[model samples]
Target: MELVFVPTPGMGHLLSAVEVSKLIIQRDRRISILILIIKVPMTSSILDSFVESQSRDNPYPTRLTFITLPPLSNCPDPSSFSFFQTLITLQKPLVKQAVTDRISKVGSPALAGFILDMFCTNIMEVADEFMVPSYIFFTSGASLLNFIFLFQKLEDDEGVDTVTKFNDPEIEFDVPGFVNQVNGKVVPVVFLEKEGGSSMIIDHARRFKKSNGIIVNTFTELESVGVEALFDQVSKNIIPAVYPVGPILELESKTRGGSQDESQDKILQWLDDQPSSSVVFLCFGSMGCFDADQVKEIANGLEKSGHRFLWSLRKPPPEGKVGMPTEHETFVDVLPDGFLERTAERGKMIGWAPQVSILSHQAVGGFVSHCGWNSTLESIWFGVPMATWPLYAEQQLNAFELVKELGLAVEIRMDYRRDWKTKKANFTVTAEEIENGVKKLMSLDEETKKKVREMSEKGKKALEEGGSSHMWLGRFIEDVFTNVASN
Candidate 1:
């Protein structure tokens, strides 16, 4: 059987899709994966290199093929129109044509189904037209998916106007399977009275219901309650079958390639010289970075914490360069005066570091993360506790789930926000706050470390033979083929 996996044009989404595809192929040698890459402006070089490396390293390279869709004729600035919105509204036709051509040449039966990124739900129509099943690949955890489904139902039942009017200072909403109320702020900003936010979410929800099933990049052991919620009768009819086959993280060899550049080698050497569990690894996701003021504050915090540190700092993008990759240089200008010299003995600051390798290192005990789901899973997989600093997207929710629900992470600033128009209108996470968070995380209270280690073990075991995730993947494969055969 062959599957066409459609990934959004972002690093996190692309990586998850690729990892899941690899899992599927490994589980069933007869199955092959064809990745449909949607070309977009503001691509990540890291993403490009990762994809190239996957093809090179795969034992059965012939089982995978990557096809890039034609780029948009005149791509608009991503700030004005999000890549998600543009892909849904404008690029659907081009993508449909590409898939249609491939299917026509290969014959519909040769392709088992479509596996789509959550953001690429618009392509499900093509699946329907071809009379084949399509599944949604949620790149985040089960809790976020459950919340999104419940949020949609609330809006539909209560009326969009009524739902949009909720402006409580700290509203608490209940979703099944979670023990506590989800903080209102952690909900997506789009669901809260933004002009197009509600409609977009509702539309995605509607599209999600149409898919045959969902494959989430989280294991059952880590989120049993949230995973169970998706299967509840109340949701079973609306939400499709869910397959929790993950902690499907980037492979270590692929992540830590043999051909390390000079800078990566230096970072590795530094790590090798450090004591086991003595360093804190700090990295924001691809889109995360702090302004000059924030950078200085972080430097101060690291110094005050007095812990060995390895910080990957990126330069903030220029004004109006939203979604553009920002360049990073040495900390000569970005850090505080003499900060580097003062901490030279204990800290190593780099423009970029191999995050997977760093997280996997024994010397690294804790993570200061932006709490993107990919980063969250990576931290969990490596048994690294986190100092959570949520920036945007569902990171706030992930932070809440980590610190509040799961007791797996320490909190930094869950309520930090910035007004893009007014550069100064932002909440600064003070140096003191950063220092406390880092200290608490690095201290590694025995209980938190124990919990993280247990979850880490469970995550790994889930991918092993006869594990929960392994069984789910097998069930998903059988269902896909069975459903098509019945049709």
Candidate 2:
């Protein structure tokens, strides 16, 4: 049996898809996997390097095939195109052609089905034409999935304008499958008020229902309520068969690699010099960075907190771009004058740091993150508490879910939004707020630490034999074969 996986172009999405694909391959050596790479703007090199490394490490490299699609012609400005729009509108035809060509091959492997990222739902039409099953591989937690279904439910039942009118100082409203009222603020901003945003979400939900099932990158123990809620919603024909087959994380060995680069080694050595559980690891996601002013404020806050820190500082993006390559030389110039000199003894700032290795280190106790789901999982996997600083996309929602719903993170700024188009700043987190958030996360009470540790253990156990996540994955594979045979 062979499965084709299509993941959107973001690092987090690609990483999740890679981990899940590896899991699928490990389960059955006979089953081959093909990854159809969609070429998008921004950085292709990062995705290229990661894919190359994964292929090198796999024992059955021949079984894993990665095909990169030709770049889109006359591509729209990335700043104007929402990532979803770019994938669904621009690349759908190319994806269809690629899959069609692969299936038409004379001696090709039997194409069992397609596993698509939630954002890649547009490919389902091709799946139908080929008469193969399609499944969704959501990269985020179950809670967020549940919220997305609820968003569509509200739109269908109460009209689109009902959801579009949501504003700050969030009003609580009941959502099906959830025990408590979900705040409007906790919903992804795309669903709130952006033009075509709600429509895109609703369309994805509609297409998701057409898929065979969904595989989320979270474990039942970590999100049992949300998992149950998802199933309930599915039972009501809100979506599809839901499978919780994860906490599928990239292994530490892969992250550490065979040899470290010079900078990585230096960062590790600096971490070695710190006391156990004393340093905070601060990194926003790959796309996360702050302007010069925000950088200076963060420095002040870190200084005021008086904690040992490792900061991964990236240069701000170009005028219109959401994220850009970090220039190491500019980091010092952008920072406050003498800030580095004053904190030189206790703080280490680098252009980029090995996040997974640093999180796993004994010296790290807390994470100051952008609250991307991948980062959230990594922090939880390492049993490090968080100081949530959400930047864009569904991060704000993830931050709220972590701090308020899950009680796992300290909030730095929950309601913050930076306009991507106009580059107008909606809000800036002050040094004091950053300081308080760091102090709160680092000084977590015994109860909170114990709770996080327990969750961490539960995540580990879920991957073991007979565990919920393990069993769900097994069932998913069996179902795929069963469906194929029946068809």
Candidate 3:
């Protein structure tokens, strides 16, 4: 049997899709997988390197293929959230051709299913054309997943548009997966808007109802309430089945798993020199960055806090471009004057970090992170406490869950949203806020840390043989066969 996977372009999104593809191939000898990669204007260093290295490590050469789709030249434009949506939409014909070409080969496995990334829901039409089951690989947490569904539900039942429903930013939404009331302002910015990517997101949420099911990148033990709530919806036939086959993390990050270079050695050495459970590690997601003013505030805060730290400070993208920041140095230009010199002994700012490796190290105690779901799961797996600092997309919603719903992280600012079109945060997080968040993060109570540690173990067990995710993986595979057979 064969499975076709379509993934979007962001590094995090694409990376998660790769990991899941590898996992499925490793688990099922009966299944051969082909991943259709959408070409875009961004970095594919991690994916390219992983695919190259797989030739040696992979036992099933014939069972796996990562084919980059033909480029979309119509736009000749840069990458942004909304632009990426348009980019994916324009590639529909390319996607159909890729799948058709593969299935028509002389001796290929039987076509079984299509695994679409959240943004690639539109490609389900191709699956419909082929008479195969389609599934969505949801890359974020389950609470946000539930909220997206509920947002659409409310709009339909209330006869109100998204923006008007979110008219009062102070109003709290009683979403099922969340124990705490989710504030309207803290909801994903996409959910509050009515056009562009927001429209696409909502349309995807509606499309989700027609798919075979949603395959989440999270484990049941770590998100019992949310997972259970999703199943409740299934019991009522409100949506398709929900499969929690995850905490599917890349345990060995690219740097640690692939090659060790000079930078890796230096990062490890610095941590090796620090006291156990003393250093605070800060990394925003791949797209995480701040303006000059916010960067100065962070520098001031770290200096005042006097904590041993490793900070990954990315320069913002060009003033108005919709893109991820490149590796930023020249700290003297944006950081508080003499701040680097004064904190030189206690803190270090580096380029992109080896996050999983650093979190697994004993010297690291806390994470001040952007609460990207992948980062959040990575922190939980390593038992590192976090102070949430959300940036974009559903990240603010993820931060709110970590602090308000899960109690797994300290609050830096739950409602912080980065405005991409304009070059500003909805509000600036001051140096005082950063300092205090750092202080609290380092001195987190043993109880909260203990809870995180417990969840970490559960997360591990969920992926082990006969565990929750393991069982779900099998179940999803079974459903793929069953649905295809029925069709």
Return whichever of 2 and 3 wins on lDDT: 3
How do these models rank on TM-score, best leading?
3, 2, 1
TM-score of each candidate structure, all chains considered together:
0.94, 0.94, 0.95
The TM-score of candidate 2 is: 0.94
lDDT string, candidate 3, 304-381, tens digits: 999999998877777767666775342346887788789989897886788888999999999999899889999999
Q: Per-prediction count of colliding residue pairs?
A: 0, 0, 0
The runs of at least 3 residues in candidate 1 whose Cα sits more than 4 Å from the true structure, single-residue gaps closed, are 44-46, 106-109, 160-163, 233-236, 253-260, 325-332, 418-425
lDDT tens digits by residue: candidate 2, 1-487: 7898999887789878888887888887768888988876666767777777767777668777788888877676666546557655677778788877887898788889999898888888777878999999988888878777777767778675655466645587765545567676666677765566777877888778789999999988888778888887777876778989888776553542433466778988999999999998899877667777888899999999999999988766677655554634336678888988999999998876678888999999999998988888888888999888887778878887788778888888877765554445567789999899899888999999888888888888898898889899998998899889987
The number of residue pairs in model 2 that clash at the backbone is 0
| Candidate 3 residue 404 C-alpha distance from true site, Å | 1.1
Between candidates 1 and 2, the one scoring higher on lDDT is 2
Kindly report which residue stretches of model 2 are placed more than 4 angstroms away from their true locations once superposed: 82-84, 177-179, 253-260, 327-330, 420-423
lDDT of each: 0.79, 0.80, 0.84
Candidate 1 positional error at 261, Å? 2.3
